[model samples]
Target: MPRETLFTKIVAREIPADIVYEDDLCLAFRDIAPQAPTHVLVVPKEPVESIDSLTADHQELAGHMMLVCKKVAAAEGLSAGYRVVINNGKDGGQSVDHLHFHVLGGKSLKWPPG
Candidate 1:
């Protein structure tokens, strides 16, 4: 079985989070440390370790995550624009082991983010 992760706790409602959107497939919430005015983490209910852990069966789930990002961004009033980021591994800046999408917007984002 996959190891439990912080995101799994959030999904199970064991850990409190400022949730912004939720559905049967995924859930989205505010980031503890906001990198932008509108920064949210969209995570799947399934505990996939990271992007590196995705399989063919997760294709629909992955696509659903992107759609969740669009919906969350629009709901957050990021009409100007938004950025969807997925950190693949430790070097890619993925803190939580679960796969998630970071929806960032509310201002002009610079290119070549660190």
Candidate 2:
């Protein structure tokens, strides 16, 4: 089995986080360092390394994460628009080992994101 990750620690309540949303399946929390006016992470409770690790059975989990992202965006007053980013691997800029969705809004995010 894989070792625990930062996100797993948070989910286990071993570390504190600025959690914004929580349900039976996942949780949404504010980013430690804000990238935009509003930046939060929508994460699944079940730690699956990254999107590359998901199987057919995990499809519902992925969809659920997206729905939670929308819910979090609205809750954060990002009615104008928002961006959901999933950094898959090293080349995709995934700093964390766990799969997570970045919900960013409250500003004009440029195209061709870094």
TM-score for each candidate, following the candidate numbering: 0.98, 0.97
lDDT of 2 by residue, 1-114 (tens): 556998999999899999999998898888998899999998889989999999999999999999999999989999999999999999999999999999999999999887
lDDT of 2 at 75: 94
* Model 1 Cα lDDT, one tens digit per residue, 1-114: 679999999999999999999999999999999999999999999999999899999999999999999999999999999999999888999999999999999999999898
CA lDDT scores, all candidates in order: 0.95, 0.92
Which candidate tops TM-score? Answer: 1
User: Candidate 1 regions off by >4 Å?
Assistant: none
